[model samples]
Target: MADDNKAHTAISFHEAAVAAIEAQKERLVRQVTLLQSKRAYHLSAIRYYKGLITLARRLPPEVLTYIFQICIDLGYPRTPLNVSGVCSEWRKAALAPTLWSNIVVDPDSDERSLQRRIKFRLDRSGLAPLSISLSLSRSAVFMNVLAMLMQHTHRWSSLYLTAESSQEVDHFLGIFGRASFPLLSNIGLRLSFTGGEVPLGVDLQEPPLAFGDAPRLNRLSFHAIIPQSGLFYESLSLLKITSLILATTPRHQDVELLRLFTCLPLLQTLILKSKISIVDGDIGTIAEPVHLSWLRKLDITGEIEMLNLLPFIQTETLSHLHLRAVVPVSEEEQVQGSLADCLHSFIATQGHALEYFELHGFYLSAVHMSSYFTHLPNLVELQLHDSDISDEAIRLFSGPDACCPKLSKLDFRWCGQVTGKAMVSMVQNRLRGSHNLHSINEVTLIHCSFVQEADVLDLAALTICRLLGKPDDYCRGSTCCQNERYRQRLQLRQMFGVGGRVRKLTKNLIL
Candidate 1:
C-alpha cells in the first residue's frame, strides 16, 4: 500500500507539469507568430522606402549625368554603357558626352564586338573633348578603328599610346599627317618591345614622328625610345613643354643629350638618363650653366654622373633632387664618397636650395655622409635606397649638432649594413633626450636584413602609422586594416625568449 501511494503521487505531479508546459508553449507560439508578422511588415517597409531613393528619383536627370561624367574623369571602372543599363534615366544620363569623353581602345581584344561597344560610346561622346588611350601589340592591326577615332583629333585633350613594337607605333602615328590636335595637353608614349630587353630602343631613322599641330602640349614622356634623326628630336623640342622625361636605351652621348636640353627653353621638370661622366681633364673651360628658371624638380636616374652634369645646370628654384645612382661596375669603390663631396659642392653653389634629397643605389659609408651632413640643413625629407649605411652615420644624424635639423622623413630600403641596435639607440636618443630634440616624425625600413622587426615596433609606439617589409607580407594584406602589421606583431610572442608571453606593452612604454 505504501509503494502504490508513492507511485500515484508522482504520476499526478507529472500530469500537472505537462499541462502547464503545453499551455506555455501555445502562448509562445502565438507570440512568435505576431512577432514574425511584425518583422515581415518592417522588411516590406524598408524595401518600399529604399526603392524611392534610387539615383533617378533622388537626383535630377541632368545632375545624374554630371555625376556620371565626373566618375569618368576620375577613372570610373565600368564603361558608361554598363552604368546606363540599369534604368531608363541612367541610360539617358550615360548618353552624356562627358561620360564617354575618355576612351581606352585595345585592338588586341575581341576586335569586332568591342568595336561596336566603343562606337556606341563614341556616339554618346559627341562634341566633348576626348582623351584617347590606346594599347597595341606586335600583331595588332586595327586601321579602321584608328581612322575612326582620329576623326576627333581636334578634340583630343590627352593622348597615351603604348605599343609593343616601333613598327606598330609608327604605323598608328602615320595617320597624324595634316591632322590637328588643337587641345592636346599631355602625351605619354611607351615603346616596349614584346620579347626584347628593356629600355627598348626605337630607331627614329624613319620619317620624324610629328605632333606639331598640338600647340598646347605641356608635358611629354618617352620611355625606351631613341630618335636617330635630328628632325624627330627637333620637332618635339619645338613645343613649349613644361615637363619632359627621357628614359631610353642605346644611351645617347653627353653632347647629343645636352643638345636636347638646350632645345626645351621652358622645361619646369626634367628627368633624364645620366650615363657619361665628365672627367676632370675632359671638361675644358666650364661653359656658363644653362639656366632653367622655371625648373623646380630634377630626377637624374640611371648610371648618373653626379659630378659631371650638375655643374652645367643652374637652377635657383630647384627644391627636389631624386638621384637614383647606378654606380658603374668599375667605379663602385669611390662613387659614394665622390658623390657626397660633389653633391655638397653642388648645393653650396646653388645656395642650398634643395629641400628633398633622395640618393639611391649607392653604397654609403660614414665617410660618404660626413661631407654632406653639415651642408644640407634645409632638407625636410631623405631617402637612401640599397645603401651601405652604418651605425656611425646614424649616430651623426642623431647627434646634438647633426645637420638636416628640419628632416622629418627617413626612408631606407635594402640597407644591408645597418644593424638594429644602432637604429634603436638613435631612436631612443630622440625619444628621451632634450638636447638634440629629435624631430623625426616618420621612419620607413623596407627589406633591411640586419634591422630586426622588433626594433621597428619600438618606434611604432611613437609613430602614428608604420609600414614594414613588403606590402605583400602581412597576411598578404588581409589584416592591413588601418595599416597594422599582423604577422609581425604576432611574432612578438616568440620574441619573449624562454617565456611564451607576448610582451606586456602600454602607451608611453618606449618613453
Candidate 2:
C-alpha cells in the first residue's frame, strides 16, 4: 500500500511541473506577439512622419506654376522643366500649358523623336503663344520637320532657324513666306551658302512677301547670303523692326544695303559687320546722311577707314558703342593718326551723351586719351582690349585731376605696356580724397605681366582700405611720409619673416 501511495505522489508531482512549464511557454508567446505589434506600429508612424516632411518640403503649387511659366518663356530644355521631371507631382506641374509654351527642335535629333517632342510640348502649351526654334542641318529629315513647324506658324511669337546650306535656307524661306506668323515678334535666321548658289525652286521673280502681318515685329537678325537685289528690303518692310543685325558676306549692292536701312524709321540698334571699304563707300554716298536719331547701340567690326562715317552719326541717343577691328592693326604710319583722330573726333562730337565704350584691337595714344576724356562727362564704364596704351598714358588717364568722376568699372586686358607701378599710382590717385572711391567696384588686369607682385599687394591693400573707409589723408608732410616709409619697412620685414618660416617648414618636410 505504501509503495502505491509513493507512485501516485510522484505521478502528481510530474504532472504539476509539466503544467507550469506549459503556462510559462504561453506567457512568453504572448509577450513576443505584443513586442512585434508595437515594433510594426512604430515603423508605420515613422513612415507617415517622413512622408509628411517630404510633402512640406515640396515647392508650393503657385510658386511651381510661376517657375513653369518662366521656363516656357525661355523655351524648352530650361532647368526648371528638367527639375519638374523628378517625380509624378513635378511632372504634372511641368506639363501644364503655362510651362511648355515654347519648343526647340534639335538639329541632330531623329525626325520622329523631334516631331513627337514638339507635339507633346505644343499639346501641353494649350492656346498660349509659342516660341519655336528649328536648328536644321542639310537633310531631308530636317526639311520634313520644318514643314511640320510651318503648319503651326499662326501660333508662333518668335522663330529661329539655322541652316547649313543656302539651298536649305532658300527652302526654309520659301516655306516661311507661305506661312502666316501673325503673332511673330522676333525672327533669327542663320544660313551658310558656301556649297553653291541658292536654287530658286519657287520663282521669287516677284519679291517674297513678309512672313505674315506681324504688326509688333521689333527685332530681326539675318546672318546669311543676303540677296544683291532689294527684294530682302521689300520683304522686311512689312514689319516695324526696331533692332536689326545684318551680318553677311559682302554683297555686290553694298551701297543699296545702306539705303535699305533708311526704311526702318524706328530702328534703334544697328549691328553691321562689313568690310571697311564697303561701309565707307555706302556711308559717303548716302544722300541725306541717313538720320537715326533714335539709335542707342552700335556694334561695328571693320577697318578704321570705314568709320569715317562716324562724323555723320547724328544719333544723340547713342549710349553704348563697341568697335572691333576686323583687319590686322594697320602698320602704315598714315593710319596712325587715322584711327586716333577718327575716334577722338567721334567722341568729341558725341562724348557728352555716351556712357559706355568698348574698344578692341585698337591702339590709343596719350594724346588721344587726354583728348577723349576731356569731353566724356557721363562716361561710366570703359574697356580697353589689346590696346597699346603706355604706362605714361595710363597714368595720365588716371591722374589725380583726371575728370572721369562717374567712371566705376575699367577692364584693361592684354595691355602689355602698363606696369604695376602705373596701375597702383592710378588707383591711389583716383581714390585720393574721393568719397566715391567705393563706386569703382571692378578692376580687371589680365595678361599684364608688367605688373609686379608688390603692386598687386599694394592694390589689394588700397582696395581693402577704400572698402573699409579709412582716412583719405595723403602722405605730404615729412612726418607723414616718414610714417608711411616706416610702415613699408615693417611690411617688408613681416614678409621676410613669413618667407623664412615657410623655408624652414619646407626644409623640415624634405628632411
Candidate 3:
C-alpha cells in the first residue's frame, strides 16, 4: 500500500508540469501573431512612403519650375516647349519670362527655317530684355531677315556677333544704327577677313554710328577691328566703357594704337594685343604718357615692343600689371630699349600705387626682378610663369629689408631653376622673422623640378587650414582665432579624416 501511494504522487506531479508547459506555449503563439501583424503594418507604411517619394506630383512648384528651366538651358529639342508636353505644371514653369529671353540665331541659317523659330522665341520672351547672339556669315539677306525682330531692339541687354567677311560686318553694324539698344550693357564682336574681295578700307571722312545707343555699355571686346578700323574709337567715345579689350590686327602701328586708347578716359581695365605695323613715313618714337587716372589693371601679351608703350601710359590708380614677353620675328622690329626702364618710368608716376605684378614668358634675371620689387615697395602679389627664376631671385624676399615686404602670395610655374633650399628658407624665414613686416601667406610652386615633396609640407598646413576662408587678419592667431567658427575650422584642420588627407596631399602637390 505504501509503494502504490508513492507512484500515484509522482504521476500527479508530472501531470501538473505538463499543464504548465501547454499554457506557456499558447501565450507565446498569441505574442508571435501580434508581432507579425505589427511587422506587416510597418512594412506597408514604408512602401507607401517610398511610392509617394518616387511620384513626381510630390515636388514643390518652385523646384519643378527650376527643373523645367534647366532642361531648357540644356537645349532640349524645342526647349521650353519640350517641358510643356510633360505636364501642366511643367508647362506653367516653362512659360516664365526669363526662360524665353535668351535666343541664339545663326545669321548663316536659312531665313525660312529661322523665321518661325525667331518669332516663337521673341513672342515667348515677352517684354524681357533679350540676350541675342548672331553667328553671322557673308549673308546680308540673313541680316535683312533678322531686321524683322529689330522692333524689339530696346529690349536687348547683351549682344554677341561673329562676322567673318566685310559685308557681314557692314550688315551687323547697319542694324544698330536704325534700331536702339537702351538696355545693352555688354557686346562682343569678332570680325575677320578670311576670303572676300571687300577689304577693311573705309572712307575716313565718314562719320561713325553712335549705336542708338549703348549708353549703359560698360564692357566691350572687339577682335580684328582695332587700329585697322576706327570703328571702336569713333563709336565707343560716347559710352562710359570701363573694361575694353582690343585684339587688333598683327600689323597695327604701336603709336597709332596708343593714340586710340586715349579716347576712353573712364577706362578701369585695358587689354591690348597687336603686332608691329609697317607704314610709310611712320617713326618708331612714342610721345608722352596719356593719363588714365581710373585704370587699375593692364594685361598685355604679344610682341615685346608692346612694353615700350608703357612709358607712354600714366595711371595714378594703376594697381595690377601682367606682361607676357614675345620676341618679334624681325631683328629691326624689336622692343625699344629695356622693358625694365619703360616699366620703371610708368611706376615712377604711380609711386607705390602699383601693387600686383606678374611676368609670364619673359626672361627675367634675379637683378631685374629684385629691382622691380625694390621700386614697387607695396607689391602684394607676384607670379612668374615659364620665367628664369633662381634661388637668388627668390632669396630677395628672405632678407631683413626684402623688396616686397607686403607680399602675401607667390606663384612660380615651370621655373626649372627654383631649388627647394631657397624656397624652404624663404617660407621658414617669412613664418618666423617677418610676421610683423609681411603678410606672407601662401606659395604655389607647380611643375618646379627642384621643389620636392618635402618642400610642399611647410606650405600645405597653412593652405589646408585656410580652406575655411577666414580673412588674413584671422590667420595671425589673433582674437578672431578664438571665434567659435574659426576655432572649429582650426580643429577640423587638426582632426583625422578629410583634414588628414588634405595634410597628406602636400606630399604629392610638390611633385
Candidate 4:
C-alpha cells in the first residue's frame, strides 16, 4: 500500500506541470497578436503625417493652379499629364482647363502622334479660350490639320501662323480670314518666300485677306510683308488697334509711312522697319505733325536720318524711344544735319517726356549727350550700344548738378571711350545721393575694355552691377566671370535634364 501511494503522487505532479505550461503558451500568443496590431497602427499613422508634409498637399488650390499655368506657359510638354501623375491632389488641380488651353502644333513632330496630342489637348481644355501657334510646312497633311483646327475658330483668343511660302499663307488666310473668330484679339503672321523677297505683284483676281468681322482684334504683326491695298485692305481698316508692327520694304517712302501712322490714332506701341533713306524735301513741308496722341512707345530701326521724321511725330506721351541705325551713312551725310543735329531737334520738341532711351550704332558729341541729359530730366534708363560716348558725357552725368535727376539705370556696351575712373566717380556721386538725385540702381557693362577688375569690384559694393565680356585681366578674380560660368552651367543642366525634350515656348502674348 505504501509503494502504490508514492507512485500516484508522482503522476499527479507531472499532470499539473503540463497544464501550467499550456496556459503560459496561450498568454504569450495573445501578447504577440496585440503587438503586431500596434505595429501596423503606428505604420499607418507615419504614412498619414508624411503625406501632410508634402508641398503639393500644403499648397492652396489657386496657387498650385497658377504655378501649373506658368509651367504650361514655359512649354512643359504634357504638363497636365506629368503633374497629374505626381499625386492625387496634383491630379485634381491639373484638371483645370486653363492649364491645357495653349495648343501648339509643331511641323516637325510625327504626324500621327501630333494629331493624337491635339485631340487630347482639345478635349482637356473644355470651353477655355485657346491660344494657338501653328508652324506649318509644305506638306498636304497640315491642310487636314488646319481644317480640323478651323472647327474651333470661335474659341481662338490668339493665333500665330508661320509658313515657308506665300502659297501656304494664302491657303491659310483663305480659310481662317473668312471664318469669324469672335474671341480673337491678337494675330501674328510670318511669311517667307523662295528668295526672301515678297513677290512684286498680286493676283488681282484673288480676294484680299480681310477680317472685317473681327472687331475685337487690337494687335497685329506682319513680318516679311509690306502693307499693300490688295494684300491687307481689311487689316489696315483696323483703326482701333492699339499695337502695330510692320516690316516695310525699301519701296516704302517716308511720307507714305507717316501717312499710314495718321490712320491709327489710338496706337500705343509702334515698331517700324525700313531700308535707310534720307528724308529730304517733302517731309519738311507738312503744316502739322502726325499726332499719334496716345503713342507711348516707338521703335524705329533703319536709317540714322529717320530721326528727321521725329520732328513731325507730335506726341507728348511718348515715354520709350529705341533708335537703331542699321545703314551706313557717308562722311558727307554726317556733316549736314548729322545724327546729333536730328536728335537735338527731336529733344527740343519731345525729349521732356522720355523715361527710357536707347541709341545704337551712332556717334554723339559730349555737347549733344549733355543736352540730352538736360532735356530729358525725367529719364530713368539709358542704353548706349557700340557708340562713341566720351568720358565728358560720363562726368556730366555725375555731381550735384546731374542732368537726369531720376536716372537710376545705365547700360553701356562697347563704349571704348568711357574709362573706369569716370564710371567710378559717377557711381559714387549717384549712390551718395547728391542734390537728391535718384541713387543708381543698376549698371550693365558689356565688352567695355576700359573697365578694369578693380572697378567692377568697387562698383559691385555700391549697387547692382553686371559685367560681361570683359578683358582677360578684368575677368580674373572677379565674381562677374564666376557668375557667368554658373549661369552657363545652370543653362546646360536645364537643357539636358528631366524636361529637356520640350523647348521653351516663345512669348507671343502681344503685350
Candidate 5:
C-alpha cells in the first residue's frame, strides 16, 4: 500500500507539468502573430510619408503636362512613351493632345510597326497642328508614309521633306501642288545624293507650283536646290517669306538674281551658298541696287570673290555678316586682287552698320585689314577661322591709332599664322584703357597652332578666355594650348641634354 501511494503521486505531477507547457505554447503563438501584423502596418506608414515628400507626386497634373511638352520640344521624342510608364498620374498627364504634336517618322522602322505607332500618336494628338518631318529615300515605304501623311495635310503646321533625286523632289512637290496646307508656316526640302556628288555644272530646274496655297508660310529652306523665277517665285511672293536658305551653285546673271531678291520684300535673314562668278560675260550695269531695308542677318558661303555681290545689295539695318571661303588654296593668290577690291567696296558701303563680323579660310593682307578695321568702327565682335592673318594685322588692334574702338570680343580658331605673343600684346593694350577703347570681355582660341600656355594664362588673368570651350575660371592649372607635341619635345630635350638620346625620345613628338 505504501509503494502504490508513491507511484500515484508521481503520475499526478507529470500530468500537471504537461498541461502548463501547452498553455505557454498557445500564448507565444498569439504574441508572434501580433508582432507580424504591427510590422506590416509600420511599413505601410513609411511608404505613405515618403510619397508625401516626393516632388513629382506633389506637382499638379497641369504642371506635369507642361514639363512633358518641354522635354518633347527639346528633341526627346521618346519622352511621352517613357513618362507614361512611370506612374498612373504621369500617364494621365502624358495623354495631353499637344504633347504628341511633333511626329518624326523613322524611316528604318518596320512598316507595320511604324503604322501602328503613328496611328497611336495621331489618335492621341486630337486636332493639334503637327510638325511633320519625312526624311526617306524613294521607295514603296515612302509612298505609303506620304499617303498616310496626306490624310492629315490640313493639320500640318511645319513640314520637312527629303528625296534622293530631283525627280523624286518634283514628285513630292507635285503631290502637294493641289493639296492645301492651311496651317503650314515652314517648309524644308532637301535633294540628297547617296554619294554626295551632285553634278558640278548642272543647272537647277524650276520646281512645279507647290505649296502655292500655304497662306501662312514664312520660312523656306532648300538644300542642294536653287529657286528659279517662274511659278515657284510667284508662289514664294504670295507667301511673303521672311527667311530663305538656298544651297546651290547659282548660274544666273547678277541683275536677274538681284531682281529675285527684290521680289521678296519681307526677307529678314538670307543664307546663300554659291560659287559666285560671272556666268558668261561682264555684269551689265544694275540700274538700282537691290534694297533689303529689313535685312538683319546675312550669311554667305562662297569664294572671296562673292563679296562682289555685296556692292549690289543695300542693307542699312544689317547687324551680322558671315563670310566663308570655299576656294582651293592654290587659287587664293590668283583671286586676291578681286577679293581686296570687293572687300573695299563692301566695307565702304555696309561696314558702318555692322556689329558682328566673321571671316573664314581667307587670306587678308595688311592693306585689306586696315580698310576693314577703319570702316567697321562700330564692330563689336570679330571671329577669324582658318585664316592667314599676319601678326602685323593683329597689332592693328592695339597702339594709339587702333581702329574698332568698340570691339569687345575676339574668336580665333585654326589660325596657324597668328602667334600667342601678338595676341597677348593686343589683349594687354586693350585692357589698359588706352585711347578709351572698350575692354575686351571675351576671347576664344581653338586649334590655334602657335598659342602657348603662358599666353592663355596671361589673358585669363585679365579677362575671360576660352580654350576649346574650356573657360579661364574653369580650366586654370590645365594645359590650354594646342602645341602639346612641341611642348613635349622641349621637356624631353631638357631631360636628355639635347643629344642623340633626346632625338630618340622625341621621335614620336614634333621636331
Candidate 6:
C-alpha cells in the first residue's frame, strides 16, 4: 500500500508541472495578439496623418490666384505657377491673364507654338502692360516672330531679340523702322553672322538716334560679333541709357567704342568685355579712361590696363566693383610702373566708397591690402575666388583694426592655406570690442579640407555664446574634444554603413 501511494504522488506532481506550462503558453499567446492589434492601430494613425498633410497642400483656387499675382510681381515666369500641377481647380485659376503678365519666347520654339504662347499671354494680361522676351537663334524665325509681335510692341516693357546675320538684323530693324516701341525699356540682342563675315548687300547701318524722344528707355545690352564702327556708337548713343552691357568679338574698332562711353553722362552701371584681337597689341591699353560720376557699379573682364584707368575713376559714387581674369603685370612691367601700381592706388583711393568688392584670378599682395582696408570703412562684403595667399598674408587682415565695422560676409573658396585656427583667431580678434560676435552672418569655406570638424564646432560654440551672452559649459568640458569626431562617425555610419539599413536602437534601464 505504501508503494502504491508513492506512484500516485509522482503522477500528481507530473500533472501539476504540465498544467503550469500550459497556463504560461496561453498567457504569451494573448500578449502577442494584443501587441499586434496595437501596432496595426498606430500604423493606421500614421497613414491618416500623412494623408491629411498631403490634402492640406491642395490650396483653394482663391489662395492660388493670389499666389499667382505675387509671382507676377516678383518677375517669375507663369508656367511654373501652373496651378494644374497642384490640383485641377488651381489649373483653371492659373490660366488667368493677370497671372501671365510676362511671356518669354525661346527662338528655337516652333512658330505656331510661339504665336500660341504670345497670344495666350496677351489675352490673359488684359489691358495691363506686358513684358516680352523674344530670343531667336535663326533669322527666319526671328523675323516671323518680330512681325507678329510688332502690333503689340507698345505694350512691351522688355524685349530680347537675336539676329544671326546682317540680313536678319536688317529685317529686325525694319520692323521697328515704321513704328516705334514707345514703351520698350529693356532691350538685349545677340547678333552673329555666317561665313565669319558681315553680310553683303545689307545696310547694317543704324538709324539716327531716335532714343532722345523715348524717355522711358533705360537699360540696353548688345552682344555682337561685328566690328565696332562709328554707326554702332551712334546707334547706342541715341538712347539716354542708364545701364549698358556690351560684349563683342575681337575687332580693330576699340577706339570708337571707348569714345562712345566717355559721352554717356547718365550711365549708372557698365559691363564691358574686351575681346582679343591679332591686329591690336592689347585692347586694354586702347580703352579711354573717363571719370564716371554717375556710375555706381562696374564689372570689367578680359585683359585691362588697370594703372592708366584706375586714376580716372572718382570713388565717391562707386559702390561695387568686380574684376575677372585680370592678369597682373610681370616684374619687368612692374619695374616700369605698370597698371599694377595704379590698381593698388585706385583701391586705396576708392576703398572707402566701396560696399562690396570681389576679385577672381587676381593676385593681391600684403602691401596692397594696407591701403585697401584703410579706406574701406563701410565695406560690408568681400569674396575671394581662386586666390593664392599664405597664412602670413591673411594675418594682416586679422586684428580689430583690420576688421570692417560693417563687414558681415566672407567667402574664401579655393583658398587652401587659410587654416581653421587662423580663421577663428581672426574672428575672435575682430569681435574683441563688440558685445556680439555673431555679427558675421555668413562664412563660406568650400574646397578647404584643412578646416576640421572640431574647428567648426568651436566656431559654432563661440557664435552661440556671443549671441546668448553666456558661456557653453558643455563645450568647455574635456569630453567636448571627442564630440565632433563621434558626431562625424555617426554621420558616416548613417550615410554609408553595412547592411544598407537604418534602425533606431533604444535601451530601457531600471535603476
Candidate that would win on lDDT: 5
TM-score of each: 0.65, 0.66, 0.67, 0.68, 0.68, 0.67
Model 2: per-residue lDDT, tens digit, 295-345? 888877777665665755656778888887766352233236655676788
Which is better, 1 or 6, measured by lDDT?
A: 1
RMSD value for candidate 1:
9.3
As for candidate 6, its clashing pairs are 97-124, 307-339, 352-375
* Candidate 3, pairs of clashing residues: 289-312
Model 4 lDDT at residue 52:
85
Better of 1 and 4 by TM-score: 4
> In candidate 6, what are the lDDT values of residues 210-246, reduced to their tens digit?
3333447888776754334556555756667889887
Residues 333-361, candidate 1: write the lDDT tens digits: 64644455566667776637678877766
lDDT for position 340 in model 2:
65
lDDT of 6: 0.59
In angstroms, the error of model 1 at 110 is 3.5
Candidate 2 has an lDDT of: 0.63
Question: With candidate 4 superimposed using the best TM-score fit, by how many Å does residue 450's alpha carbon deviate from the native?
Answer: 3.1
Question: Cα-based RMSD of the predictions, in order?
Answer: 9.3, 11.7, 12.1, 11.6, 10.0, 12.8
Off by over 4 Å in 2: 1-99, 105-107, 135-154, 163-182, 196-208, 227-231, 234-238, 250-253, 273-288, 302-312, 326-335, 395-401, 432-439, 460-511
Worst 10 residues of 2 by lDDT: 502-511
For residues 47-82, write the lDDT of model 5, one tens digit per residue.
878776788878998999999988887689879899
lDDT (C-alpha, whole model) for all candidates = 0.66, 0.63, 0.65, 0.71, 0.73, 0.59
Displacement of residue 87 (Cα, Å) in model 1 is 11
